[model samples]
Target chain A: MASPRPRTYAEAREVSSSNSELGWWVFMRISGLLLVFLVFGHLWTNNIVIDPATIDYDYVASRLAQPGVRIYDTFLLFFAMLHGVNGLRYSIEDYTKRPGRRFWYKILLYTVSAIIFVLGTMTLWAFTYQEMGDAVRAIGATQ
Target chain B: MYRGREGQWAFLLHRVSGVAIALFLLLHVLDISLVMFGPDGPFDAFLAFYHNWPFRIGLLMVIAGVVYHALNGLRIILMDFTTWGVRYQRQLWYGVLGLTTAIGVPVLWIVVPQIVGGI
Candidate 1:
């Protein structure tokens, strides 16, 4: 399709502004770059080198015990959430154009994003491993 | 016809793939934690789980899911941000396939050698 003609001064604001579009452009570029490394490193560690064939509880626990792996994971956790949230935001923008809808959508997005971020952080950090597994295993067995 | 089934299929596949990967991630964490705890049997149990063909296919499907979810998300972002991107959504969808496959090849490269070695 051919590009649309330039908008008049008043018309420019009436149409979508480059300012907001530009913001998304910057976001896309930055997230895209971060995703490249975060994604590749995540894949390399998790899939390639780790050898899922040998992956088990202690393997993961020891890895997480390391300051480096923990730090790397926290970054992955943060960036994955950020990128996905930004994506959802853009999706809402695509389907809903009404101001009321957009406003409520943003509110909902922020709320849900916050809840997920909190939950993800909790799991990434405060996750109590083996807190219940052996207990359940014991209950399942007879003395 | 193309609009209806294709959109529905795309949405369904995206959801399916997402849930698949998320489940894998959850199980992965639990399995890792198990390794941390029992340190032996639990790890062995994980190996046992992989021996099942259904689980093997399910795992591959999870990789496919990640490929689709991440690429589809990119397509959506491009459509929203770029000036002419939406107009080229179909082309972009194909581009995602190309990109996903290209990146995915390396992953498959690793996967194939292992499967071959195992066979």
Candidate 2:
């Protein structure tokens, strides 16, 4: 079984076993700090400022049309995805007893997460939401 | 590892909340990405489905998890970095729980009514 999580900075450095592991240990702390703000802001805007029930395609589209929202979401997406994916990896290591199962589970997790990450990035940057709505409207009229 | 105690409970809750939030984050990204399919796509339909009372309740739980996880995560950070952090770890945990509940009440007050009215 893997060693217990280190409780102190010195213990973390000594018990890390490798530079990459130490790096991840540090990364978790840094990312977690940033996510507190990012996630709370996201939740406040989406869930509290407006009634979530009224959020539709147009609502999201209009929001994404702003450059500021795009930038904010990009940071939120990057940090949250990396932090969350790594957290899941830690859980897999903790719970998955069999080595074979653990290996396959991580592979599957990374692959799916990578694809989803790409899709999310594309959604943020690939097309203008305003044009997307207009294009759909034009297509509907033509039909 | 720490066995049964307040610290242990704190650790257990942190892990459970972390894992739960991580899974939700993955699904959240995937669903939100549906917007790429354009305005006429299944984005609204999928959102409508989730806006149902059951899913709204689930979303509330996710929010709860996030609040707890975030506060406890700060506790963990403190324990790792500061000298007094470990000495007062138990009290820090109580603070975490207290703060989570403090934030949770207002959140529920805002969300519960929305859920009820949506139904």
Leading candidate by lDDT: 2
lDDT of each: 0.62, 0.90
| Clashing residue pairs in candidate 1 (N, C-alpha, C atoms within 3 angstroms) | A57-B32, A57-B34, A57-B35, A57-B36, A58-B35, A58-B36
TM-score, structure 1 vs. true: 0.58
lDDT of 1 at B110: 79
Cand. 1: chain B TM-score: 0.75
Model 2 chain A worst lDDT run, 10 consecutive residues: A129-138
Give the share of true interchain contacts found in each model: 0.14, 0.73
TM-score of each: 0.58, 0.94
Model 2 docking tier (incorrect/acceptable/medium/high)? medium
The residue-by-residue lDDT of candidate 2 on A18-55, one tens digit each, is: 99989999999999999999999999999999999999
Question: Which regions of candidate 1 fall more than 4 Å away from where they truly are?
Answer: A1-37, A77-143, B1-10, B36-43, B51-54
TM-score of chain A of each: 0.62, 0.88
